[model samples]
Structures are given as C-alpha cells and as structure tokens.
Target: MSDSQRFPVAAHALAYMAHKGAFSPAQAAPSALLAASVPTNPVVVRRVTALLAKAGLIATRPGATGGSWLLRQPEDIRLDEVLKAVNGCAHIGSPPAGAKGCPISEHIPRQVGKALTAADEAATEALSKITIADLLDENPVSLAAYTPHASCPVAA
Candidate 1:
C-alpha cells in the first residue's frame, strides 16, 4: 500500500466521534478525549484537532466543560477535506524526481504525469462525496472495541 493508503488520524478521530454520536454542531471533545480515541498523545491529537478546527469542521472550547465537537453536520464533512487537513498532500502517489536527462521520464511522455495528476483529481473528487455521516451510518467498528488494551493505543 502507498503511504497515502495509511489511515489518517483526522479520519480516525472523526470516525470515533461519529460512532460515539459525539458530533454536535456545538459540542467538542477535550484534547484528552481525542487523544484517547486516536490512541496517541494529546499533542498529536491537538495537532490534528487544530487542523480540523481551522477547516471549520470542528469547534473547540476553553476552560472546564470544554471539548471539541463537529462544527457542522456529519453529512457536511467530506472525507477528502479530512484527508487534506491531516495529510496535507495530494491523495495520489507522489512520483520521485527523475534523474536529469533520463530519457524515460523526460522524453518518453508527459501523458504519464498528466494521468497521475488526473487520477489524483478524480480521487479527491470522489472522496469529497463521502461524508462523516456515511461512516457513522455504517456503524464503523472502533479500534478499542476489539483491542485488549485498557486505554486507546495513543493513550498508551
């Protein structure tokens, strides 16, 4: 699998919120809660949370009773947005720079590069159609449900 195929923490965190029915237009999770679900430290969750928060996908609160929550309906949040927020790169594979004067990469065709770019565009378009609500409806199984660990992987 490509590096892009690896699950992004933002997606995981959102899915967790969805499964728990924690997605409220005004509600938000505390850094600790997000970290626990993602099975990572608060710092990592904070990073991802900040990204989502910036995208207008989630809202955060300060002081006691403060936590993060979905800022919009789950149906309004696109998978592609989440992917972009966390990964910060095109979903399609990134090609390595070719050696200078390499005939195959340079002279052979521009079509290959165009095709890759097109594929990435198509993928993002398709991903944009999927929303967090779709995932919630599917009853996505949580990693903690099957794992024996007392806390989430991140918390450990």
Candidate 2:
C-alpha cells in the first residue's frame, strides 16, 4: 500500500472494528475478516494493524485464534490520533537538494517544506475534530450489513 493509503486503511479498520463491536479480545476480528472489509490482502491488514498496535490504539494476539481489538472506545479515538498512529505522510515527499550557488533552489526547498508542514498541521487539526465514532455515526452500518443499494447515498 502507498504511504498515503495507510491513514484511510487504518481508519476503516478501526471503524469496522467499532461498528462490529470488537472491543475486547474475545470479540477481536481476524486479519482475514478485516481484509475482506478492506478488499485487500490480509497481510496488508496485518502490517497496518501492527502500526496501530504500536500506537496503543489496538491490541493483537498471535496463533490460531489470533486477531485484533480496539483498546479504547471509538468515541475516544480521534482521527488525528489515528492518522498519527499510521503516520500516513500524504503527499509530503522529500525535497530535492538545493543546487550550489543557486539562490532559488537553495531557498525553495525550505519554503516548500514549511508549506507542506503547515498543510499537514491543518489536516491534523481538521481530523482532530473527528473520531472513529464519528465515522461510524456517519455510516452506521457494518460491512457485513452493507449493500450496494443501501439507503445511504454515500454507500450507493
């Protein structure tokens, strides 16, 4: 997955778990189940989940019945927290090395970096107002219960 996609995948996984009521180990959702909802490979889900686990958003277990579950309620898991947890560097590429003796090239990189940093901060601020619960509240349906012709226009 691209670095940019990490945030969405992480958010979706958390919302899915929350929507499915997977709040504890006994109700944990397996990577395959999460993968089905994401329409991606289970390995990809595992990789993303590892980052979430490291961020203390979720917990995972290994072996036959191994799976993952949220460590906190959805309402408490802000989108900013999730984004940071995944560290999805959306479109903030490494700046080119400035050319020697070229004033424009030397200063442009720094200016561009500042702009990118500001944009990232703005995004975090916007997301901080949202939470996994807010996402679930917007859709309010689990993938298991989702339909192409659902009442929600977004889903359709």
Candidate 3:
C-alpha cells in the first residue's frame, strides 16, 4: 500500500552486491540476476539501481558484460545512505489538499505530520548506524559460498 518496501529492497540489492563485490568490481551482477535475488522484476531492480548509481552508492555499466558494482566497502555504506539513495524513508502520507474549514483536518496535518516526520527522522538515525557489513556479519552463512544472485540457498 505504502510502497515503503522500496528502500529495503534497494538496501537488499546493495547488501547482495556487497557480498559479491568484495571479490571484484567486474564481478558486479546484472539486474536480471539481481532481480532473481530480490525475487522481483529486473525492471524494478534497474529503476532502483539507477537511483543508487546517481547517489554514488553503486556503479553501473551498459551493454554486454555490463552490470553493477559497489562504489564503496560494505562497512562504509550505511543503511540510511542506501535508503536515501532510493528516497525510501520519506513519509508518504499527508493531509488532504482541501482542509480549509475543518478543525480536525487542520490539526491533523500539523500534529500527525509532525509525528510522521519525527518517526521517519528517528528511523533514519537508527539506520545510519547500520551498514551492509553489519547485515552480512550478522549472517554466519554469508561467509560461505552464499553470494548474492546465486540461485542456490545455503550449501550443505
């Protein structure tokens, strides 16, 4: 409904890239491959990746043998930065356009708006402390052969 998951998916793609990019930048995965990992469409991956590329979070190449590479180390890339790349954490809802007469409508924008803004800011602050490295480090299995875009799950 809110489509609030866009940022997380973007972050996921980044973390996934981080897993693979540590090996080499040329090993950057394609959007179709990334799509498979995100379990979403390649177009969605491209759209988000474009934003990330513009934000300098990742680098992309076109044509045959081209793909995305992480622009920085996972430890240096914060979650909030990824979210900001996709404009992911922005508040989506707002008071109705015509609240000229109603008291509840008038106050809702001021009060509720403030609350939503504060919540988003708090979330960003919390995310700022976390990095793609944190996500990978938190997962023991990632140290194995579980690179992103790899079709297989955990190795036995």
Who wins the TM-score comparison? 2
Candidate 2 lDDT over residue span 130-154, tens digit each: 7888777745433335444463245
Top of the candidates by lDDT: 2
Residue ranges of candidate 2 with Cα displaced over 4 Å: 92-94, 139-155
lDDT of 2 at 76: 92
Candidate 2 pairs with clashing backbones: none
Q: 1-156, model 3: which lDDT tens digit per residue?
A: 135767867887988888876335569788888889878888888888898999998888876677788878888888889888887766757756546898787677788778879888997897787788878785644234445446536535
Reference-based TM-score, model 3: 0.79
| Candidate 3: segments with Cα more than 4 A from true spot | 1-3, 22-25, 90-92, 97-99, 139-156
How do these models rank on lDDT, best leading?
Answer: 2, 3, 1
Per-model TM-score versus the true fold: 0.68, 0.85, 0.79
